[model samples]
Target: MITQNSINQLTYEIIGAAIEVHKILGKGLLESVYHKCMIEELKIRKINFKSEFKVPINYKGVDLDFDFKCDLFIEDLVIVELKAVNEILPIHDAQLLTYMKLLSVPKGLILNFHSNNIFREGQKTLVNEHFKNIPK
Candidate 1:
């Protein structure tokens, strides 16, 4: 079973991987660069994740053909969205939340690779009702 504590630990590791990538690459790079580096980092850490994971859409009990992709789906527990923008907008948060809802995951994170300090200004974590319902 996935408890709140387990999710928290997994989130911590994911953030650490992002920070490591940012530390080596420094920022202002393309989102693809960060995406690739994150993939390597996760592999080095033995973390399981799917890159460019397609989130299936179902409407009215019918599966849609639209392709909604998440940057990273970690351990089937978190949805991580990567960005290389000047700032994190509401749409970015919305995107992550939407992915979380679609995947029924408890946690989501937005990692912007354009800031000087990734842990401080470059990262945003969000959780939904699924998270609240989990055991701590």
Candidate 2:
């Protein structure tokens, strides 16, 4: 079983990679640019992740044609959503939360790469009931 501590460790490493990308690239790049750079960083760090992983939508025992593509799914435990917005928005958080609910993930990180300080102000980590039940 996955533990909260383990997921926290993985997220910590992910944040470090994002910080490194931010330090080297600085702000104001496109979201796709950050996404690609983060992919490389995660690779160098040997983090197991799936990029643009698809999540199928099912409603009332019916599978929908629409699906949600999460930016990154790390260790199949956490979702990493990349953005390059001017600021983190409520909609972004809501989107991540929705993804977590659909994917049944414990936690998620929304990393916006357009901030001057990525670590201090560009990241937000959200959790759900799955997270609450995880062992510390």
Candidate 3:
């Protein structure tokens, strides 16, 4: 079973992978570039994930034919959003949050690959009530 501690540890690993990718690739690449590098890093780290995972949208008890795609779905528990923008805006956070809700996921990370210091200035982790309910 998934636990809070496990999720935290996985997030740490995810951030470490992102940091390694940034260290090698530096900045100014496209989001897709960083995404491919991240996937490589995650594979090197032996982390299970799905690329471009799709989440269906439902409204008024009806499922929509179209779906939203997330950058990375980690262990079926966390969502990773990749960005190559100058900075992470509120809309980015909103987008991740919306994906989390639609996917019924507990946690997510927004990793922007456009900063010299990716850890300090380029990463953000968000959790929802599903995370709160996880056992410690």
Top of the candidates by lDDT: 1
Over 62-108, each residue of candidate 3 has an lDDT whose tens digit, in order, gives 98887579999999999999999988999999999999998889999
TM-score of each: 0.98, 0.96, 0.95
Candidate that beats the other on TM-score, 1 or 3, i.e. the better one = 1
How does each model score on lDDT?
0.95, 0.93, 0.93
- Per-residue lDDT of model 1, residues 25-122, tens digit only: 99888999999999999999999999999999999999999788999999999999999999999999999999999889999999999999999999
For model 2, residues 1-136, the per-residue Cα lDDT tens digits are 6788888988999999999999999988899999999999999999999999988788999998766799999988989999999888899999899889999999999999998887899999999999999899
Superpose all Cα atoms of candidate 2 onto the true structure and report the RMSD in Å to 1 decimal: 1.0
TM-score of 1: 0.98
RMSD in angstroms between candidate 1 and the native structure over all alpha carbons: 0.7
RMSD per prediction, one decimal? 0.7, 1.0, 1.2
lDDT for residue 112 in candidate 3, whole number 0-100: 90
lDDT of 3 at 104: 86
Quick one: ranking by TM-score, best first? 1, 2, 3
Q: Candidate 1: which stretches are off by over 4 Å? A: none
Q: Evaluate model 3: give its lDDT.
A: 0.93
